[model samples]
Target: MTGAWWAAAPAMLVSAAILLVPGLIATAPLRLAWVARIALSSAVSIACIGIAGVAFSLFGVFFAAWQVVLVALVLGVVAWLIRGWVPDAPRERVRWWWLASAWVLSALLIAVVAFWGVASPEQFSQTYDNVFHLGAISHILAGGDASSLTLRTLIEPQRAWAPYPSAWHSLVALNVQLCGVSVPVAVNATWIAVCATVWLPGVAWLAQLIARPFESGRVALIALPLGTAFGAMPYALLSWGTLYPTFLATALVPAAIAIPVAVWPPRFRVRVGRAVLAGAAGLAAVLAAIVFAQPRVLATWAVMMAPFVLYFAWRAYRPAWRAGGRHRRRAVTALVAAVGALVVAAGVGFAYVVFRLGLFERPLDDRLGGPQAKASQSVAAGISQVLGQAWPAGSTGTISFPSIPLALFVIVGIVAVWRGRRLRWALVSYLALAILFVIAAGADDVLTKLLTALWYKDRYRLSSALPVFGVAFAALGILVSARWLGHRAVRRRTGAVAFAWGTALVSALTLVVSGGSSAIAVVFALPAASAADEVVSVRQIQFLQDVGRIVPADERLLGDPWDGSAMSLLFGDREPVFPHVNGQWDPHRLLLAQRLGEIETVPEVCQALDALRVRYVVYNPHEFGGGDPIGNQFFAIHDAVGAGLFEPLLTDGESTLYRIDQCGRLPAR
Candidate 1:
């Protein structure tokens, strides 16, 4: 653990350097102070590293340790030059006890969520996506290159344009290089770095933005604990997609939504510095970073950003055009310019996505998605799905749930904010996002297509962003109630004292309602199996480790990718004959799986090996996804061994490592 943390240090430092200037530049525009500045900086830092990796790749940098370090140094110099542009630092320090308390609670919850159910062997999320994710890491490590363009060409030859973001891979790869820890340990620690640097800070900044209307730090303070309390998200995604990148992107959603809205505020105001330009540029870069990370997450962000856009448009135009304000003429002119700028930015981003990213090369395809998993759940049904654990069964099992508590906060928040004229935009924004979540619950039809631009259709991923608005309203609800209940006591005690007590009471209630404790317990109940765990037992892993010692790292191993092939590639530090790339391009891998099962003779198996250009075959009976056809393939390997076709270099109870190079001659036939 200590070694892993030490390894993660350089990655963290590099990431922070990448974010510092942008974070400072975004401060005044974002009103990022105290903890929020740190949060935005951390999230932006992650984006900076991602941008650096792809940028370096585009320049044909091999993404070796030295090249990446040089890139980081370049970014550091740029940040230093820009550091002079930011001048809104507080003249005198104000101790924000509320921000401090929020930090303590948010850190506590993030730590619990980061490590709670996580353990060794399967140090990372052991969900389905683990196969591709782990393979991608090992795939990059195998060739010792992290070039985004050519990273996976070794395992996946078809596209050579595998556009998956290098944020997660790049960070892990850097850790592996600098830290000297195994990939799995580095992978899990990378999760912690993402939490501390991005999600925790992003949410803190977002909570401040949502609570800005009240001019109350209490809202920001209470929001985080309540937000982190919701278990299904951030934690649930671990089991769901093994969604590492999605988690990082979702963490930045609040900042993405908030910064744009903040740029176009409710009323006409003049900024008297380079901040106007620097902040806009910084925010644009931040948005681009996420589009690089996971383009699909931008959909939820747009939905959440819409009401704010509407608010900005209304405040900028209606009064000014009607000649209602003191500076009506100037305001109207500014409004037109602001709107025009937005149009230009939108056009550029659209061009980049449609022409540059190639995101929808096959949009309706299963990989990119069509109207497949349409939103079917209404609000209630969706809540049920979040809480419905397949554990303990019946009476006691359903005891762990999120709907009741979250719904309580939802209702309370709605009622509290329903009448605030100043918060109408905030209230409307929250309601709009909630409605989007509901609509996305079941239908990925026309509405979903229009909103998400057919980029992604799965509602599960969108739900991860739910806490942004949910926590906003939840904290507001608690704040409003606390203030109202404390109004009378203001006379007897100082208003601050009453407010503090009220905040404490509501915070406790939120903790219980968010089901933070239950969420932790639920993670344990949810089953997780790594590629190694899924396809091989302990004895099998033990034998493979021994075989890894004998099989030179230069030799590529031949085995079915869907089985424990990644474990060999990952643990053995050797490439596999097959790694899971998209199937349309690699149907031959399945054909190979089928052929291995169909072949009988030692020479025939050798012929198959010749195609892959390999001499080693690792076989396990309990290959993932067992059924008749696959069973037959397992039988073929067994029979080939029985025929004395290949020499078994190593054997466990039901698994064998065969050295195909030493196979005996086939009988005359």
Candidate 2:
């Protein structure tokens, strides 16, 4: 019950925060849209400044402050260019039905991601780095003293010496403390839930924005559902923290695309405030940085939208030069200010890079790194085969899923384009981008040479483009179905019947190909699945959750970083005992699990685990076979220590936990 309550706190607090921000803006004395936009943009700007400053202060990363300033400046330039683009229009009333549908659909997807999906092996195993760090963090949250925890923990040592950023972990800890819950669970749940809430709103909100230019509820409804579905995947939302800024960075992609399209400029009378487009870009840059701390997301964003950026710049420049009066001067000032801001931001970011990376070097040296030849390689190949063969299999069934309304909408979108609707060009452009990404991502060489330089190496780099494709497909479906029903030659009921019957037929075909009734049932059952409240309570699960909390914040606790990070938010400013990234660290423990019986050398295995100061052995039974000797040896070791080598902490049938004794050992480093 306590665990459940702790989990609920953050959700409730976020809900409250969401209401407060808009309410305060709405009720302001000179309430106007630009006021809200500027305020949010400014707050985001300041936050970035604070984050970079924190990094600099703690790690002596001198150029961190400049990165924040650089991003804000660039956004200012973009806004100045687009300042007058918004045309005067009446205050549009919010469409409740559209909003309701979007929220409902997104909520359903969250449930599926949270409950139905299998846990990830790559991310959720023991003997991975970050495990002990999270365990130590949990201990601190559970009432372990932080001063001792930090001094005694491996994560803290990593924080001081290694280049890992503490922003995400620290932020989660702060939220958990404020919510007054078990820091570990609340922090974990908060990351997962917040990722869904923040990004999904932007995704669905994009539909409304895109349809604004068209002024069609049908278009908005069709597009928003597709966006919601794109983010609903189990892997996307729940895989936070473990994946770090990548998930957060990916979430920002849609928002980067949407702000220019959706956010209406303030009425022309208010010339002092930032333009909506500028504010949007600024916010996107800052948010993108918060996750990955990578400058590339912003650069890609600017590059991708260069045409739009250029158009706005032209609008601002052309009018000012033509007016040749006070207006011309005002335009000149805005242009100068904008350019100045971008220059400043760029300078700051560059300086920070130089300070941390020894004169603007990449984290990893520029080498072929090596091919991904394991299961990851296999998965990449599978993804390639799906694209090459399945794409040409016919657009008819490639995106088909057994949902009636969705099927009809997709069909309509396709037909609407085929009939030479004016919107077809935009749809075509969107599809072109998705197809390009899918194709470019397939070749390991191409992926390594291009995107992996900016981002990490992953075939799933194509995932970002999926949402764009999803919305396009959904739009095509809706347009085609609507046209068929509205044809003048058909009787009204007959036309409606034709649309419904055709939709059903297509849906059935999709179900047949998608593994028959079970897959179909799962798809349809998504919305009906029960949504978990703010907190979920499991009996023994809370042990790991609490143990992570109670360990002194500075105490070094070793465990699998992969699974350890799931609830790591509770740990106060700690690092994972094992470092997972770049594979530069040792992996003897993992090898122990892999080659348990045939290893013939028990002493080496025990010595490695001990040397790592692995105080807690968290064994995920799901990943290890029952007959594995490492599992057997672990039990034997625990028994030898009166099972005192580890205190039996938590157990689900799927996972087991044991707390390791210090054994009179001193902290590493």
Candidate 3:
């Protein structure tokens, strides 16, 4: 098969895998049930497609197409295998309206990706997460095995120094293998869009779980617009270009928590089934863990859900034990869920250990760098930080359509506090926790707050503030609209439905206008660094290619210690020491703190390279003597290493490389 056809093969495999399991086709007697399943299936397809696209980008488009096919096959197999185990209740008949809505939302997301990809593909390059991770994968896929220290050194320190999850890298690598290696943006965008869609059903399911036995069609209905608004934040879209994949990972956390809690009551009765359910819950937790390494996300979800889990267990067993029925059974089920979840977590931890996962291997980063820490000192302050960053910039600090929604939620929250609705009370408690997170997140001395968050074992990572804030506002809007629908004059069925439709319409319009405005601002803010430079010398490029070739595939070559960004992206073997963003945002501090600020004499430069065990140095003459070209602190060291201290390695038309050979002077005093 052609490379493109081969690239698309993985999608077919994943799709078939999901579709052909023994019970997959059997479970869908009713059209509505099938529709929901299909929607989910489609989501899986989209995610695989996106991931494949990104993986292939590093290789080629043909490989990307194939990776999508593989992902589809994998998802299909999983869906098919698990088909029989899913809850089998025929609820509302599948409505055309639902399908149409799903289609529209999917279309919008696709359009957004296309617009960005075609209009500004460079935005996706050299991001915080992608560069280090993708570059590392590129190194591996290029025939340099993972066993090399080059891979280890580049990946390990980041795991120690930075704060990002490992799923994106792992996923990218998988796609590269399946899709071939070109460049992975197409697949990455597909993954982002797919991930964005997962939240819709996930939120619906969560609403159902929260409502319990009482059908929550209304809750689910409201979730569509509100969930989309919250999920499709500017950061998530803009971040697609960057390596930060938090939004993608966070998309599934609520459902993971909800699923376990939702089934607790029914599963408490059956021994085998309950065990399976517990395991499923645990699996969900594991998935959430994989997606989010931050403690705030974990802590918030746990805090919100833990009480409910405890209450359910207590209520379920208290009566049974008092009435002479078996209490051990329920206790055992809860234990199974907890233990299963723990087992899953252990497996994830092991994968992390084996893979040298994340920016840092030690757990302290997650534990120490979160908001939970700040909350402990002063709940009020933590809550403020959590609330501030939870919403988009313009959405907060002032009253507007989006901001008004938040204000209304606050008002309803007050009413709920006075009137005493149990669920509403729970929401209030969540808000209180959210406020604490806000405070911690926004504080100036955030490091202290991060430590506090970490101390809770990173339980506060969920930062309950985000979901709580969004849900609270959406719930308030629903309550208001429901009340309007209840008026006698509006008692007509047509009027009520019309009102619901109107609410959705207004919400969509508001989100579109607000999101559009933000997108425009971002487009205009691009810096010169983003543009392609015409002054790049062919000789300089050749020098880098040559150095890359000389560096042992097994041994990483550190760049000119000072200019890690351009060199790391363009030439270095191992993942760079610091993340691309850190290098970009604080290159001066990083260099100065790391002592790259003092390499004046040839001996100093040579000694520094030797100390770091660097094999090759790709020098940029223009960057070295120029006025802090990127306005980074790179110039601080330029004056230290005056022209005479170095010898030329390569001189192209526009640029020259200088080799540090230890001028006769002794090392610095």
Best model per TM-score: 1
After superposing candidate 1 on the true structure, give the runs of residues whose Cα lies further than 4 Å from its correct spot. 1-32, 58-105, 113-115, 118-122, 151-155, 213-219, 266-274, 323-380, 383-400, 403-407, 439-456, 487-536, 581-591, 594-612, 625-645, 662-669
Pull out the clashing pairs in model 1. Answer: 39-201, 374-442, 375-441, 375-442, 375-443, 376-441, 376-442, 597-633
lDDT value for model 3 = 0.41
In terms of lDDT, model 1 sits at 0.54
What lDDT tens digits, residue by residue, belong to model 2 across residues 395-485? Answer: 1112223354543464455555556543443455444444434444344453433333333333233344445434545544544555555
When sorted by TM-score, best at the front, the candidate numbers are: 1, 3, 2
Task: Provide the lDDT at 57 for model 3.
Answer: 43
In model 1, the worst 10-residue window by lDDT is: 389-398
Query: Which lDDT value does model 2 have at 598?
Result: 28
The list of candidate 2 runs beyond 4 A from truth reads 1-98, 117-175, 178-192, 216-222, 231-244, 262-296, 310-436, 446-448, 468-484, 487-555, 558-669
Candidates in order have lDDT scores of 0.54, 0.40, 0.41
Report the alpha-carbon TM-score of model 3 versus the true structure. Answer: 0.61
Candidate 2 RMSD to the correct structure:
10.7
Ranking by lDDT: 1, 3, 2
Root mean square deviation (Cα) for candidate 3: 9.6
515-627, model 1: which lDDT tens digit per residue?
43343333323222222334444465566677788776666676655456556877666667666523333544444554554444334545545544566777665444342
